[model samples]
Target: MTIKWEALLQVFGATLLVTVLVVTLFVIGIRALSDEKKGPAYASFAGCVAVVLYGLSLIVF
Candidate 1:
Protein backbone atom coordinates (compact mmCIF):
# COMPACT_ATOMS: atom_id res chain seq x y z
CA MET A 1 0.00 0.00 0.00
CA THR A 2 1.21 3.46 -0.93
CA ILE A 3 1.51 6.10 1.81
CA LYS A 4 -0.15 9.45 1.25
CA TRP A 5 2.72 11.54 2.56
CA GLU A 6 1.21 14.87 1.62
CA ALA A 7 -2.04 14.21 3.47
CA LEU A 8 -0.12 13.09 6.54
CA LEU A 9 1.98 16.24 6.47
CA GLN A 10 -1.10 18.42 6.07
CA VAL A 11 -2.78 16.88 9.13
CA PHE A 12 0.38 17.24 11.17
CA GLY A 13 0.79 20.88 10.23
CA ALA A 14 -2.84 21.71 10.97
CA THR A 15 -2.72 19.99 14.35
CA LEU A 16 0.45 21.85 15.30
CA LEU A 17 -1.01 25.19 14.25
CA VAL A 18 -4.23 24.69 16.20
CA THR A 19 -2.35 23.51 19.27
CA VAL A 20 -0.22 26.66 19.29
CA LEU A 21 -3.20 28.95 18.79
CA VAL A 22 -5.28 27.39 21.59
CA VAL A 23 -2.39 27.32 24.05
CA THR A 24 -1.51 30.93 23.35
CA LEU A 25 -5.10 32.00 23.91
CA PHE A 26 -5.30 30.07 27.17
CA VAL A 27 -2.12 31.72 28.41
CA ILE A 28 -3.48 35.11 27.52
CA GLY A 29 -6.62 34.39 29.49
CA ILE A 30 -4.62 33.31 32.52
CA ARG A 31 -2.48 36.42 32.39
CA ALA A 32 -5.51 38.63 32.08
CA LEU A 33 -7.03 36.98 35.12
CA SER A 34 -4.00 38.00 37.17
CA ASP A 35 -4.08 41.59 35.97
CA GLU A 36 -5.83 44.37 37.94
CA LYS A 37 -7.92 45.70 35.12
CA LYS A 38 -11.40 44.17 34.90
CA GLY A 39 -12.61 45.07 31.41
CA PRO A 40 -9.72 43.71 29.38
CA ALA A 41 -9.56 40.65 31.59
CA TYR A 42 -13.17 39.76 30.86
CA ALA A 43 -12.62 40.34 27.16
CA SER A 44 -9.58 38.11 27.16
CA PHE A 45 -11.46 35.37 28.98
CA ALA A 46 -14.28 35.60 26.49
CA GLY A 47 -11.84 35.36 23.63
CA CYS A 48 -10.24 32.28 25.14
CA VAL A 49 -13.62 30.60 25.59
CA ALA A 50 -14.62 31.40 22.02
CA VAL A 51 -11.45 29.90 20.63
CA VAL A 52 -11.87 26.73 22.68
CA LEU A 53 -15.50 26.31 21.62
CA TYR A 54 -14.60 26.89 18.00
CA GLY A 55 -11.87 24.30 18.20
CA LEU A 56 -14.30 21.79 19.68
CA SER A 57 -16.77 22.48 16.91
CA LEU A 58 -14.04 21.95 14.34
CA ILE A 59 -13.25 18.58 15.83
CA VAL A 60 -16.92 17.54 15.97
CA PHE A 61 -18.03 18.79 12.59
Candidate 2:
Protein backbone atom coordinates (compact mmCIF):
# COMPACT_ATOMS: atom_id res chain seq x y z
CA MET A 1 0.00 0.00 0.00
CA THR A 2 1.15 3.52 -0.83
CA ILE A 3 1.14 6.28 1.79
CA LYS A 4 -0.41 9.59 0.89
CA TRP A 5 2.36 11.96 1.97
CA GLU A 6 0.50 15.14 1.07
CA ALA A 7 -2.56 14.22 3.13
CA LEU A 8 -0.36 13.27 6.08
CA LEU A 9 1.46 16.59 5.95
CA GLN A 10 -1.80 18.50 5.77
CA VAL A 11 -3.14 16.81 8.87
CA PHE A 12 0.12 17.45 10.74
CA GLY A 13 0.05 21.12 9.81
CA ALA A 14 -3.55 21.53 10.88
CA THR A 15 -2.90 19.84 14.21
CA LEU A 16 0.14 22.00 14.88
CA LEU A 17 -1.82 25.17 14.05
CA VAL A 18 -4.69 24.27 16.36
CA THR A 19 -2.30 23.39 19.20
CA VAL A 20 -0.56 26.73 18.95
CA LEU A 21 -3.88 28.60 18.81
CA VAL A 22 -5.20 26.88 21.93
CA VAL A 23 -1.99 27.48 23.87
CA THR A 24 -1.88 31.13 22.88
CA LEU A 25 -5.49 31.65 23.92
CA PHE A 26 -4.86 29.99 27.29
CA VAL A 27 -1.78 32.13 27.95
CA ILE A 28 -3.65 35.30 27.04
CA GLY A 29 -6.47 34.37 29.36
CA ILE A 30 -4.07 33.80 32.25
CA ARG A 31 -2.24 37.05 31.64
CA ALA A 32 -5.46 39.02 31.44
CA LEU A 33 -6.70 37.52 34.67
CA SER A 34 -3.46 38.41 36.44
CA ASP A 35 -3.67 41.95 35.10
CA GLU A 36 -7.16 42.36 36.61
CA LYS A 37 -8.94 42.33 33.26
CA LYS A 38 -11.94 40.03 33.53
CA GLY A 39 -13.60 40.64 30.15
CA PRO A 40 -10.75 39.63 27.87
CA ALA A 41 -9.79 36.78 30.15
CA TYR A 42 -13.23 35.26 29.95
CA ALA A 43 -13.44 35.81 26.23
CA SER A 44 -10.14 34.07 25.64
CA PHE A 45 -11.15 31.15 27.82
CA ALA A 46 -14.44 30.88 26.00
CA GLY A 47 -12.65 30.77 22.69
CA CYS A 48 -10.49 27.91 23.90
CA VAL A 49 -13.52 25.99 25.09
CA ALA A 50 -15.33 26.57 21.82
CA VAL A 51 -12.42 25.17 19.87
CA VAL A 52 -12.34 22.11 22.09
CA LEU A 53 -16.05 21.49 21.73
CA TYR A 54 -15.84 21.84 18.00
CA GLY A 55 -13.07 19.27 17.84
CA LEU A 56 -15.11 16.89 19.96
CA SER A 57 -18.13 17.32 17.73
CA LEU A 58 -16.03 16.53 14.69
CA ILE A 59 -14.95 13.30 16.29
CA VAL A 60 -18.42 12.31 17.42
CA PHE A 61 -20.29 13.18 14.28
Leading candidate by lDDT: 2
TM-score of 1: 0.69
Cα-based lDDT at residue 42, candidate 2: 100
Best-performing candidate as measured by TM-score:
2
Model 2 alpha-carbon drift over 4 Å, by segment: none
lDDT by residue (4-50, candidate 2, tens digit) is: 99999999999999999999999999999999999999999999999
Q: Alpha carbon lDDT of residue 37, candidate 2?
A: 100
lDDT of 1 by residue, 1-61 (tens): 9999999999999889878877776677677778766677777777767877897998899
49 Cα displacement, candidate 2 (Å): 0.3
Each model's Cα RMSD:
2.0, 0.4
Model 2, residue 15: displacement in angstroms?
Answer: 0.2
What lDDT is reached at residue 36 by model 1? 67
List the candidate 1 regions with Cα displacement exceeding 4 Å.
Answer: none
What clash pairs does model 2 have?
A: none
TM-score of each: 0.69, 0.97
lDDT of 1 at 10: 100
